[model samples]
Target: MGVTLTDSAAKHVANFLQKRGKGIGLRLGVRTSGCSGMAYKLEFVDEVNEDDLIFETSGVKVVVDAKSLPYLEGMELDFAREGLNEGFKFNNPNVKDQCGCGESFNV
Candidate 1:
């Protein structure tokens, strides 16, 4: 399994890319930080890297570096609006525990 994006997520990304007019896709990765020791990082990719694993979902490419694949595999990204708050949400199966603020996780 690999990373995926919900319809809402794909649409949101596509709209952003269109306005920015220079991105190849979205990049997902991990970093060593946060209380749970791991945090998710997302960025707009202008080019693909040789070691990156690319997953296409709903016509949008989600790129992950080789090192982050193990942790991000099978994850589904979603865009949601709840009352006054709205943003991307990660549904990660590999996560075992998450911090109170929901910004980091342990696997």
Candidate 2:
């Protein structure tokens, strides 16, 4: 399976793109960092690489590089608000464990 965005996530990204006015979509990737060795990276894409894999959910396009596909496949992106905190959350099936601080994961 490929990456997907929950309705809330799609709506949030759509709103951001609308506000920014120059994005093609959102980019999802992983970086080598943090205690658990891997961390998620997200950004708005104004331009896409030719090799990027594009998936659409709720009318929003999500772009991911081929190198990140194995790590991010089947992941579900969500947006949530918890009291005073709010942000994007990753529901990654590939994650075996996460660090205690909740900053990174091992897959």
Candidate 3:
């Protein structure tokens, strides 16, 4: 399985890249922190690493490092707007539970 991006997510990323004019793609990963033990990380990548895995959806490149691939496989990223709030949401199948504050998860 591979990472995926919802149409809304892809468009959101593409728009940001276009406005910034320097990123090759978006990078996704997890870090050891937060109340639930793990938290998602997102960044703009100017270059791809040797062990990086790339998945494309709706013409946007979603890159992940090899170490993060297992945990992130089959995940879908989405962008949403809820009243006055808007942000990227992760639909991770590997997640077993999330913390009450919604900033992190446990797999």
Candidate 4:
């Protein structure tokens, strides 16, 4: 399995890209930091690297570098709103634990 986006996430990303007018897609990755030892990184890509792996879902492009593919495979990105708060949520099957602040995870 590869990366996927929820309908809400796809819509949100598409709208943002429309306003920005330059992005080719969204890039997802992981970095070594945070309390749980790893944290998610998200960015809009204007260009994709030749080695990048690309996945498409719900009309949105999800790009991941080869190095990050193992960590992010099978992940579902979602847009969520909870009362006064709203943001992107990651449903990562590889994750084994998450920090209390919800900013990082261990796999």
lDDT of 1 by residue, 1-107 (tens): 99999999999999999999989899999999899999999999999999999999889999999999999989999999999999999999999999999999989
| RMSD of every prediction | 0.5, 0.6, 0.6, 0.7
Q: Can you write out model 3's per-residue Cα lDDT over 63-106, one digit (the tens) per residue? A: 99999988899999999999999999999999999999889998
Give one digit per residue, the lDDT tens place, for model 2 in 2-87.
Answer: 99999999999999999988899999999999999999999999999988999999999999999999999999999999999999
Regions of model 1 farther than 4 Å from truth: none
Alpha carbon deviation, residue 90, candidate 3 (Å): 0.4
User: For residues 1-107, could you state the per-residue lDDT of candidate 4 as single tens digits?
Assistant: 99999999999999999999989889999999899999999999999999899999877899999999899989999999999999999999999999999999999
Error of 4 at 32 (Å): 0.5
Ranking according to lDDT, highest score first? 1, 2, 3, 4
Model 2 lowest lDDT segment of ten:
16-25
The lDDT of model 2 is 0.95
Q: How displaced is residue 107 in candidate 4, in Å? A: 0.7
In candidate 3, stretches whose alpha carbon ends up further than 4 angstroms from where it belongs are none
**Candidate 4: segments with Cα more than 4 A from true spot:** none
Q: How many residue pairs clash in model 2? A: 0
Q: What is the Cα-based lDDT of residue 56 in candidate 4?
A: 90
TM, every model: 0.98, 0.97, 0.97, 0.97
